[model samples]
Target: MAFSAAESKLVSIFCQSVLYGVYVVLFTATTYTLLWGNKARRSVRRHNMLFVSFLIFVIATMHMATNFSRIVLAFIIHADAPGGPAAFFNELSNFTQMFGSTLYVFQTLLGDALVLYRSYLVWERKLWIVAFPCLLLLGSTATGIGILYAFDKVVPLADVFVVQLGHWITAFFSMTFTTNVICTSLVAYRIWTLNHRRKHGDSMRRHALRPALLLIVESGACYSATLLALLILYNVDSWFQYVVLDSVSPIVGIVFSVIMLRIASGVSTEEGETALLGESGVVNSGGGGVQLSVLDADPDQKTVAV
Candidate 1:
């Protein structure tokens, strides 16, 4: 079935709206965890995470708002204009559309950078480990900007599957996909290696690391899968790409916040209070990185201090 641009836009808006609502609830819970959920003392790391959370939430909000505006312009404001909503949405150069695209670019790059940083942290701050992923991120940023510029210069009302924009967009998508896969793999490997090294420990301690690794892999997979779908649909010139594209921002925010809340949940005290406390000073507490806190293991307790 060949779906029209307007149909894609309608589906995109609907999916994005639902995702945005979910993101709002997750963001609220994440905010509470970072702010007051910690029964123990708060550190600069928590504050930093809170700040980044707020920033990402704001960006997602703006993306959603711009999308809503675009919807209005396409469906209601210009319903009877020529080709109707399809033609209106095809105007990628329009300011509102451009702005939303820009936000998606920014949100994606920010998430990639955070993943790279997390990789660096989990690898014990080994600068050499993240060196290549950094380069990939640079490539992603360049191609991302390139695509945006190309969008403005492309023939008015032309779809994004055209030659001028295709190359840049493909490069952007591929680079981002590669960057995320590499960084996420690195983080997951590091966690596994650390756990493997502690194989002689008690079962509780041995199983503690699994949750962290699982959380990282599961969360990373969500974003990677989305990107892969986008890359495939884009190359095939499917109108369904718009649905994936519009949902990207909220998905990014949701994934990021989910990690925060999950980790906080893991390290929560036994009294059913959620907290993220590091036994040895501050661990990998950077914003958006897997905040790994090594709590002192107790022989009698089956606590998850990953």
Candidate 2:
């Protein structure tokens, strides 16, 4: 489908405006949830509070970078009247694009780290849990270097691959989605086997697996929506639809914050102790009174909710 010059200009303006609006909303929600949310301060939750906080900051940065990029593009398009201001804006846009690309690499790796951490918790493995984050760091650094090199060497290829194909690939094959499914499947298999063994009896193991189950399902749903959007609408000029997808991260962030807050606020005694150790994390009190903790917590640690 081809767009007339006027139509293309209108679409661009609409996209830029929507991006700016979502940018404001996302930054506000992220700041409030991290800084002043009651659940955010709890000491007993199992999720990595520091990592979550860091993720929030990264999301904010992403939004800000996008917003600045949009503003620069808008200025360049409408800069019929020339001045030093237009030249400065052009330079600023170039810088933001570089920074934004770097941050996107970090975001991808961070998602992978979270997935690995969650998987380790399910398997009750100490080694995998420790190794995954280190692996992610190395992977991120290498990917960042590769992206920089590609960006510098092949302009057309980088624009198509990095700018367009990157989002398309990630929307479907993101580390978060892949890991969540794998971990959840493993957990489900275990739950099924436990249930089979207890065909004529009751098992507490089923209860212990509930939180992981819920998290897996939720992550799957969010990723599914994102994937659908990418598949069906990403290349289309449906500003409204793209905005919906763009807004997904912040909305997911808020939902996660709320659920986490609830869990943090109601940690059990054993779980609280576990939280302090920094090994196994605690989900809030619920589901047949099962208290789950990991074994890899550092003995010197305190303040476990994340």
Best by TM-score: 1
What lDDT tens digits, residue by residue, belong to model 2 across residues 51-106?
A: 67557556745755574564556456645545422332233225554565455455
The local distance difference test score of each candidate is 0.76, 0.43
The residue-by-residue lDDT of candidate 1 on 23-126, one tens digit each, is 99999988887777653125446766788889999999999999989889989999999989888888879999789889999999999988887777666688
Model 2 regions lying over 4 Å from their true place = 1-51, 75-93, 126-141, 156-158, 162-177, 184-220, 224-252, 267-306
Query: Where's the lowest-lDDT run of ten residues in candidate 2?
Result: 268-277
CA shift at 241, candidate 2, in angstroms? Answer: 11
Q: Which runs in model 1 stand beyond 4 Å of their true positions?
A: 39-41, 199-219, 264-306
Total clashing pairs for each candidate: 0, 6
